[model samples]
Target: MAVGLVAVGAVVGLEAADRAFPPPLAEAGMVSAEVQDRDGRLLRAFATPDGLWRLRTQARDVDPRFVSMLLAYEDQRFYHHSGVDPRALLRAAFQALTHGRILSGGSTLSMQVARLIEPREARSLGAKLRQVLRALQIERRLSKAEILDLYLTHAPYGGNLEGVRSASLAYFGKEPRRLSLGEAALLVALPQLPERRRPDRNAKLAEAARQRVLDRAAVAAVIGAGEAERAALAPVPATRQALPTLAAHLAEAARRRAPAVMVQRTTVQAPVQARLEALAASAAAKAGPRVSVAIVMADSQSGEILAEVGSAGYLDSARSGWIDMTRVPRSPGSTLKPFIYGLAFEEGLVSQETIIEDRPADFFGYRPRNFDMRYQGDVTIRQALQLSLNVPAIRLLDAVGPSRLMVRFRRAGVRPALPAGEVPGLAIGLGGLGISLRDLVQLYAALANGGRPVQLGDGVEGEPGLVDGAPLIDPVAAWHVADILSGVLPPSGSRRSGIAYKTGTSYGYRDAWSVGYDGRMVIGVWVGRADNGAVPGITGYATAAPILFEAFAKSGVGLTPMPRAPAGAVRLAQAALPPSLRRFSAGPAGLVSARAEDAPLQIVYPPEGAKVELGTDAAGATLPLMLKLQGGRAPYRWLANGKPLTTLSRRRVNPWLPDGAGFSKLTVIDARGRAASVSVFLQE
Candidate 1:
């Protein structure tokens, strides 16, 4: 019965083999090839359906040492075998049966290549017989050198790496040709158990597998015993390279735009990218758990983004896979103030010397206060901007009209996120509208580049404007705004000042911003909690300004002072005395009389010098000068030659009529008891 059953089984197996026999396997063809930049280095690979993960070709010449080591460890008789080795298969089958599980693969290099090229669905007993038949067919059709080349170029080692070229780069972080003997052995050992032999995940197991390759190489006489020993003992150069979080983000972005088939050529510079990564890493390390940082660096002249750092580390749980914060929109705080001011200047609604009241005022229920809650009563447009006085900015915003400012912002590439039907108010000047850092940087660049709005894109040229001929704003106005901004550096309190900048804090300190430009570069910085919570006791001037200064100072971009305004483009004037000093007079004997209060105040000469005689006919004649008081009230008393005259009400001054050529002193006492005296010459 047993003999009959064996005959039946053998007959059935023969029948199954006959039925399973299909057409001989053809050589695996290329599928898709992808090229990408890894940490600024270019890498290319080919993907095949049935091979490892992807197949990659050697860059130029195959590294003979790597090939020799792989052949020695994987298939000692690879050169002599025709696709399949019967003797090795019998030995492997015996070991598997005794162990009750498969422990080794006795397939020759050609058989492995067949497995790689053919579908795994063909792995049945009958399928294995077919694979053997196909192996014989492949050997008959291709030469030994061709088979070796196909195997080396098409086999998958691990992790999206199809061939030895990619495996060399992925595993050892070096080219195949540059790999050392031990490194080559490491690659050779990985294919047998790719997952278990990953160096990053299983160092000990990988090391053990590496030793197995060394042992095999020795047995095959691929290397001398001493050489093999030395190679095994050599340090593995154990460093692992990982893509930084920011670099990874950029890579992913590049991949998205081009996919696996198209190669991406970006404007990102490797050295600049390295520096940006370092800066982001340092910032992340310093910021700790609560804070995350994102940075974007671009060329001011060309608007080419040179570098970008998205986060501290790619694997960081808190920030990993988050949308790039640098590109996202957030409340710009005071960073938007310059644009508003620039618009006002361009429209001829205000100038650097224009007086702006900085006192407390409400605009449509929104009352903007200075960061310190301190008010400056009256200041020039230049001083208000330099000091970042909130009240003055709010007043200026009201004067310039919020709708008009919004139009200018849109023209500059900033799409403000203000609600429709929302009345523009003082808050608008304080960056109440949402804006992106990219937009802010571009706006500032417009000012730096002479009023030309930069077209923000990978390589698109900005439209020709006032600077470039499209005329978004008068180049002169933009230049004037730049001049005012250039004086805002080092903060109002810092001793070192050379930068024109503006600082802004959002409601509750959720965001802080410092945006500024020199002749050559425009930079904007934002500091805040990623969660949109206030940083206790921090403001734009205190937080973002320092960072901006550091970036510019370290960037090696020299500061070029903005061009000065023409001789008569702007002028300055001091506030006049209070109304009480308008009328007061000095007597003939150099005495000031109480009755002089009714006399009209006038200047016989300018301050700092005077000549007068009370009896002179010229002295009795009225002078044309009059007193002008600024925004406050104060008491005043007039004196001639150290004699007290009549007390004058706010802004009240007495006129002086000179009689003959002589010098007379006039002293004016303020409400605070402060006195200023001047002498005028009485000329006939």
Candidate 2:
């Protein structure tokens, strides 16, 4: 009765001690932050706060053979024992006592995991007893599988690497899901003396350690002797591989967003990201030490950013590579011209063949000149855009209110940065405003997706999806712009990619940009110093366009044909165009005289048999009729009912008051006596 009472008291005391000191299970939650591709391939990983590469690992993520080998080598009775194996411990103690030295520690996998969670510097008996007690507590709280997971996650593998996954990736350059016999054995033997037998630093020791695991596995009948011999012949990796850093910038950004999440999944495709990263690095090296490159490739239909190269090299100090140029707002130069033309097309102000003057022009004190300082006398609307003429774009932007153009841009899921306290103006069409490469890509994606705007996501923020706003432009107008841009000739020595693209160069050669798209994918490239410093003689056509074409070639995505012409979209010849669309003229505010080379004279406004409204003001005086014409020889004559109402005029616009509110005929005769007449009913 006394013995039984003593035993019960000891048990009660042990239970109270266990309750007083619970295991630090929360340490298991501190794992390395990882950024993975859509398919779960690691793009980049940031170390834990303690500077350890301790990735979270699960038994299912490792090869079954490796797991079996680890169990067999570390703890033969792992499945049978709750936390400690008595038979193994007795044998170790007997051998140590008989030999007068500690030959084996008799530690189970659970004890090893406990030590990993709370490491101790001394190998004293007290430390061992503490580990054994912690192991018991761990087993009571966690299942066998969870304990194994902790071991797999916290097991040391030399240097800063902790987890089997990090070790495997570093030594073998692949995942642990599919390891060879030799590789499995090596990994099973690593955690025992990780630093002394590191494959990268001590290949001979690593090989010897692996051989011992193989020989033991054979003797234990886990593998045949013949198979062990074959596995022994396999060579150990002599060097450690640098882990994947394909999307470094994006990975860092994702970590900042969700610091607590162990693994952050992105929409990035690993293959595409790898290829573009290589391209950006190579391109930057060739460009110059100070020049940096940024590229963004996205799906127009899904709005997913397949690959985003934020800089030429994330660590290139000369190029300020840490800056994410894709998101940095800078002058876009002439890249915004297409949208201006599209707005004009949507407003029925011009057609593809409309003759628009590219001569130097002024808009409310803002004068925009051609890039070459020489203008194409009177080019078609298509030619003006294909040539990237500055004056023509400003003219179109002036006609279609700049504020309206900005509204369209907002529909495309981006708001361009305007100068402080300044309203949208014509200079914006000439690269006066700032926009990022991502914003530009989003806008072009809308153009490629038939004017339907899509909001892009880089897997870091959210899924790429369609925007709820209206289309950026009408389908017909978008098609017209695509048709014109597609006809733009490729850069010298480069083959056509069958994609619609545009190029731009900011003022002072600060930035060169190229954006292109097929039916499905859109890519934008920027070449400049990240510090916003100028690189002389750098033009978009000569520098950025080639990179754009090369990216399309190397992106590994098949070309999706541009969308077919939408309803109401047609390429009209100059002669077949509507009178208004045949020749584009700026409003009275920014109009310039038409040269003799302009299209034949014709009255654009007040189409034949149309009603004219001339409402009176508060003064009750008759308001004069405003007549507008398109092309005409200078010094034109205007007549009402065969009577000359005004002397010969050099301007295409004229005003007249009808004798009374009734049917009237108006005629315009140019210097060549070529007359075009329009009849209309007047109403007050």
Candidate 3:
């Protein structure tokens, strides 16, 4: 009875000690963060706080053969023992006594994990005793699988690489999920003396160690004798490979967003990203020094980014590669012309074969010229857009109103950056506004997906999904745009890729952009100096368009047919077109043959400096005010407070809605570009 009491007291004392001084299990959670592709392939990995490449590894994350080999070599009775194997320890002790040396140190996987958790420099008896006790506490707190996971995560394999996953990536350039027989045996033998047997530095030691594990496995019948012999003949890696760094910008962004997340999964495809990055680098190199390139490829239907290359080289300081050019706002040149034509088509004001003047023209005070300083005189709406003519686009923008275009862009989930205190204007159609490559890609996605805008997500911020809002343009208009763009000839030395595309060059050659899309994918490319410096001879068609074509060719995705035409989208010949649709006129009047004899434009009603009372609705809201005008020509554009009204009017009587009771400056421009203004005090 006395002895039983003594035993109970000892058990109570052990329990109290275990409760007071728990193992440092939190240390096991300090692992490196990883960014993976859609298929869970590692894109990049960041070191831990202490600069160690210690990736978290579970039993399932490793090859089963590796786990079996590790158990057979490290601890034969690992599962049978609670923490320390008594029979193995006794045999080890007996062997040391008989051999007069330490032939083996019988430490179970759990005890090794405990030592790794709280490392000690000396191999003293006290250290061993502490490890045994800690192992017992660990086994009591964790299951067998958990214990194995801890061992796999904490085991060392060479300089700065701690864990089987890290070792496998560093030495074999792949994950530990599917390792070869030789690779698995090498990893199983590495933790015993990681530095001494590092394959990159001590190749002979690593080979010898791997051979020993294979021999032991063969003797224990864990693997066949012939298999062990074959494995033994496998060569050890003599060099270490760097972990993947594809999508560097995106990976960094993801890491910053969720710093606490151990694994960040993105919608990017590894193969596509890798190919595009190489293409960007090659393109930039061919372009010249101090040149950088950015590319973004996404699915038009789902809006998921398949690949995004932010720069030519992530570490090229000469090209300012650290900057993410995909997100930078730069002049968009003539890329926005398609949208202006789209709006015109939606309003039924123009058709593909409609004749439009492309000569130098003035809108109020803004005069736009063609890109090559040469005019095409008169060209079809399709030819104007295909040629990227400037004056025709400005005329279309003036007719449709820039404010309406801005609203359409807003509906597409993008807002172009305007100069401070300035509103959207005619120059915007000519790349006067600032937009990013990503934003441009998003805008073109609407055209590819039947006028439905898609909001793109970077797997880190949000998700790619269809947005519920006003259509960017009607389905018929969108189809018209696709038809015209698809007919644009490819650049020299490039075969046609049955996709619709457009190109733009920012003013002064500061930015080059090309955006293209098919039914399935949309890719946008930008090439220029990141510092916004001008490249003398660089133009979108020459610099950016070629890269775009090559990117699509090398992207490994087959070209998908463009969407078929929607209802009422038939392309009529010039003769068959309606009288109004046959030729685009600045005014409702078909043409003004003599402008000198025309009456001067004037607002007859609401005479200058007059106060007018506005009628209010039942909800106490001010109603639109009617203003009459006797104009120089038909088709007058009205603007109040520097904002253009939604549509052009040919009836001379136009309505203006006041936001509230205030003085508003109302201006009207006639077809001959004649303008008149009136300031009226409006009161409800």
Candidate 4:
């Protein structure tokens, strides 16, 4: 009975000790972040705390050949032994006894994992005993593969670099999944005295260590003798190469999203991203310094951001490169014209071939002009949209109402920023409001997706995607817009392709934008100063559109035909059209009775309380002082300082030659004898 009691007491004592001195490796230290592409390729890696690049690696991620060599050199009987090697221990003990000094310390891969998790500075018997105990405990709990994973994750390769993955990338600028013979041997040798034999620091010692590993590998039959000899002669790297910086902005964002997660997978395709980034970098470099570029490519069907280059260079300090341009709100120039025309189609106000007057017209005193300050007179709805005529787009926006367009954008998960205290206006069609590139992409994606634009994001089947059920415009309208855009000419030198795309330039050329989509993908491009500084001679057509075309060629994504015209869509000649559908009229006359009191004509430019400096012509010669009106009838009369300027005939946009610099009252009287006036200081 006493012997039984003693045995039970011993069992209880062991359980208590196990609980008291459990392994200190309950959690790993700050593991370096790993951002992977959709196909499971590394996009980027960030260092851990203490400035170490210790990315957690699994045994599966390592090359089989490297694993074989690692086993042969580091621990011959790793799988057979429990934690410590009895043969090695006895050999070390006998050598120490015979030589009266220690030749080698017996440490198995499992024991090394234990030491790595619970590092001991002192190289003494007590520390060795603790490592053995922890290794035995780990072996009892984890499988052989798990133990190897732990070792591979924690084993030191060189300064601030732990794990084979980190070391492989630092030295070879590639993944450890495919390593050459010399590379495999070098990786196997570095863990022991990592700093002393670091290739970047001491190439000779590193080579010698690698040769030793190769010899051992040959003897163990992990590699043939000839292969080992060839590996021994292979050169060691002299310096560590930088890890990949592709899709840097997105990688950083993913890391921030789950900072504690060792590996973060994103919905990015590495090859496509690499190509787009290269194109953007080349374009930005030729454009100028302090100019950053952003590109966003998404699947129209899925709304997944397949490739996103937030900036041309994430480390470019001169361009404020850290900022994400895709999220920044900027004026989207004529790019929104397609949607405006689509809205008009949806409203049954016009069809593709409907005759629309592109002449200068005033809207309650706000006059719109074509982009080049030249008028094309009357053109078909398709012609105006294809030409990106500002007056026609504004005329359409006026008819549809900017408020309705804003509401549609909201339904598609887009929110355009309006100027403080200002409501949506016809000017918005001319890039007066602010919209992020991503929001613009989402809206366009909706049009490409048959009027239902899902929210733009990075998601897949396992994770819920952001999808909006509401249509941005009717399916027929979206289809008409796509057909027209597809017919627009591709950028110069680019082959004809079936991509429905549009270009835009903000007022003052502060922003240039290009958005295009095939049947499958939507890509948005933005080129501008992050600080909103204007870039000279840069327009969407000249800059952003070409990039869009080149991006498609490099993207390697297959071309998808634009959606066919919906059932209700129609193209008609002016003579065959309904009278109401013949031309778009959005003035006071169109909305109000002719007998109603005529709203007083007003001047939108040369504000009564502001100063204006009319810029000179392209040749630095006399600059025409532009005169614009909003709410006046055709054949309007104007006076400058009570002096007759001219008797304007027909729908007119006239410019007055400023008489030097001084304050002047600019007045205009329409055919109805109703007048509006503004006083301003003009600089010549």
Candidate 5:
């Protein structure tokens, strides 16, 4: 009797010690990284650090119907019961007495949670008592809801699948937030014998198990008899479904941003992302082998990224699809032409009606030719930009100074990549430098955003825009550019209307791009071999433009044109323009004597990126800006921005009056398209 009393005292002592020091719960807490889209829908899930595909879920992430079915099928009085059910225990005892053997295993959901947390292999009485003790201990520590959450998160579903979210994705290829009656019943039945009744392993056994749940559902009045019968007939999944893997590139980026974080919310809309991924895949297949596609869609109002597809296929080896092409630098053909024209308009150097010659021209031994090797001879500034003429754009770039354009891009948060040790040259006007699709889209978005730049991101989290700096360009210039682009012909068979778009084909056909924007959104697309090798016969107009149009169509956004013309935008004809603007008349301009061949061409007046206000004459009329000559060939053809002046003279001295306020480019082509330029701010 003394020994028995000592044993009871020892048991009490052990219980006290157990309560004083509980086992750490973190041993079972490994969870996968869950990347969600803008609406908080899971975009993709990565395995745990331990390489397990466990996505631990809370009770709220699951369908209420699923939770109810789980409780009804597993434990009827789960809410009322503690660690162990006395009524169930007594019933098991009565059945054991009648049958002279153990009949039902009377384990509450809490006891199962205990087993899951502290597993034991032996089925001995000592082990059973230990499980009961652990359950009671756990009940005292966590609330009923928390205890249920532990079960919902850790319960085995099948094959590497644990928890309802992972199982729901593996079986139904979706979240567990919403489930049909049949789906709920199957999930409820799986945890009983996860591996044994795996749908992929044995559909018959899985279906049979699911039917048993349906039978119970009818008896418990959880569902009508007809509903139960239909649920029982619902076919079980024959194989595990693939998980959500959209936005793979963004998924990796988010992971890198917060490596230790298990869940990351990114700036992407789930539906648009999914459709763009599908469209990318389709474009790749049709573009032949070794070809890949990249696309970006952003909101102009807030600069939020709606969709970004880095490649056609993340696992496609032939196309080097793992590369994030949106961030990659490639030549941006005529995509920068609109910006060039916009700057000219801001400077009042030229209006849309100012005539410019598109003939072959040379500057400092560098001759410029059109893409098709044919010249339009004479075209207005509006026509020149719309047609993307090489010579005219080069003349504008020469005057604007390529470096100045680069500075404007930087202010707008974009940087184009240039060759090592190479200076900005007139070639840059015709796709000479490299710019990423992402940066290009951001620049175009500025035009749609009324000359302001909205930082690109998912709006769930704030992405800061330009830090209180001046707008990228004058609103009137931006408006004019948008209006001109809106009139550019759309690709064949495109049903879209009113999208201001531009197409670009890089040198050697290495890259093709089509970026477009409406009043509120911008989308940029790139099609090419990710390896940077040339892909012949694929022009931006033929390949990438169509994809861009289709992407906007599938994006479910209404098409809106650019906002109304900003203040200072004037509608005038060639005859209505001022005498100085009536006809572009640029004289031969030089920084050195006409006979000085050793000196490189340079701008003498209105220095590079200089802000110059108009000087008034005796009559109070603005005096012309003096042009000095020094180097290069005589009879230089001068241009204000891209417009050819009516005069081509051997005399070095030239004159240009300020027509308005804003930025302007002044260029002088010395026989060759090889030219000298300066970007100056002209003020009235």
Candidate 6:
């Protein structure tokens, strides 16, 4: 048989010599190396041109237990045999024939190393002869320990993971020194069928293969029979090291900063990253498999992204492999509206007291509707923002003009994917433009940092810019917007408190978002399908808001109110208005009669106090106030002090004095009978 194989090889060699076939070259001193994190954590690894099939022989520092287990299970006579075991080869061939499959392999560890260093092109008689020759050549040139070291370092365990060093960390989450006898056995069994023995893929089959290793060890006298039995029966402790999604994202981000060949120091806190991953996984499990989620958390002042979850799972997973929903641009929904209204206030285009008509109106070809599909006509700019009114936002956008608004968004660090010549309509205020969740978080971070622009970084050094331009919104305007947004909590509009939040749902419910900021951090969350399918009954308020709240709560991030504007920051009054209502004025006097067509009514006294205290019923009291009128007729509803008087017959009545309990608000209805509001401070 040996002579026949040699004859066949000679014939094949002649045919191959006439062709381009080259003899596999054997080289000395070839080695592959890997870099790992402290605690034997797998950071990265590389393979040589010889490929990843060479016999791995660990350094003397490597645990002897791992080496013992490898030889005991793989080739019992590895130390004594030159390269091949003639008796074992015959037995393996017989077993293969009886099983009618390639269930057993006869290659000794040394032969495997030979094939790895000088790989065969085909699994035929000629290739086998060449492999045998090379194995003998290797045995003559290297010692037993050297051969074992080569085999240990170059074996492919599974996936991109190679070598026992990497496999030890990947599976057992421990160093070879820490591996138990059972774990050592499991690692040894993997080289035979790495895929079938993968812990994450087929844990049961892997355990069975591990048991076989212990049985073979005992039979070969490599381990005592009692020891082998105990090892075989020992429970494999569940791996404690979970692959963190956020950590993976941070690593990817770090890799971008430096090549994979270079080590990167990242700002990722393992505990924080683990918490973020847990929160995202819990949220995703509750959200169901179809809903894709992305979260980005950043430091408001430093603009460093502390945590980011690109998707629920790795991008390579079959179920979650389409688009990277986090990076893809989607309509930011109402999350972008705050910036528009914020820019308006900052630019002096509008003020909290400025009465904007919230009645339904059409712009050219687009008609915008509120989330509830209800019209709230004549709402104050403050109320418009607090309630997230659609019409008021569009009206404000109309007043600011799309061109200038887009410029403000760009300045605020929002890069909307609006096409050239695509007019920014009223819808843009309600997230008509597509933007990424990362951009949304950066924009909110800018708002939290006092209108200072944000720079998106992968925990690397970079200057934070105010989008494409200088600071667009004035500090005072940004402060006011934050102040109003902070009040939109549960029973008000959101379940999150102390957070300047905005919830948005795009048309067709393709995307839902809740982006906001507290005193120190800015958070942006997105929920939807990777395929852009609308999740039934899933709205931004229902999906994204709660996730944001839960994430902040779990992270123990408190919501401290942003600091008040500095002492010198100028607070501009309603000085800059459109020419139509610029002339309309009312003095420091309380609610006076007005017409609806003139201007929607506004209060100018008590400084339009927010969070003012008043008795539940101030039956008869004199309240100092002022009234400014915009377009509209008013048979204004009257309030005694800060309480509403049933009749407007008597403007001043002594019976309206404070009862000294709960707060009171005086609201007036226009002649059009729309709700008009005013507040006054009353000492209890």
Name the better of 1 and 2 by TM-score.
2
Query: Model 4's lDDT to the true fold?
Result: 0.81
lDDT for 359 in candidate 4 is 82
- For candidate 1, the per-residue lDDT at 362 reads 58
Residue-by-residue lDDT tens digits, candidate 3, 250-295: 9999988889999999999999999999999999999989999999
Best candidate per lDDT, number? Answer: 3
Give the candidate number with the greatest TM-score: 3
Clash counts per candidate, in order, are 54, 0, 1, 3, 21, 39
Tens digit of per-residue lDDT, candidate 6, span 388-422: 88877776565444555665566665657864556
Q: Write the per-residue lDDT of candidate 2 for residues 393-493, one digit (tens) a residue.
A: 88777656566577678778688887876666678998888899999999999999899999899878756989885688889999999999999999997
> Which lDDT tens digits does candidate 5 get at residues 218-258?
88887888998877877888889888898888888878778
lDDT per model vs. reference: 0.60, 0.86, 0.87, 0.81, 0.79, 0.64
Candidate 4: segments with Cα more than 4 A from true spot? 1-15, 27-29, 96-103, 255-257, 459-468, 570-684
Superposed by TM-score, candidate 1 places the C-alpha of residue 538 at a distance from the truth, in angstroms, of 3.4
lDDT of 5 at 594: 28
Give the TM-score of each candidate: 0.58, 0.84, 0.88, 0.82, 0.84, 0.55
Which residue runs of candidate 6 sit more than 4 Å off their true CA positions? Answer: 1-165, 174-285, 315-320, 353-355, 362-367, 459-469, 490-497, 555-561, 568-684
List the candidates ranked by TM-score, beginning with the highest: 3, 2, 5, 4, 1, 6
TM-score quality measure for candidate 2 = 0.84
**Distance (Å) between predicted and true CA of 397, model 1?**
3.2
Candidate 5 local lDDT, residue 503: 91
lDDT (C-alpha) at residue 34 in model 5? 84
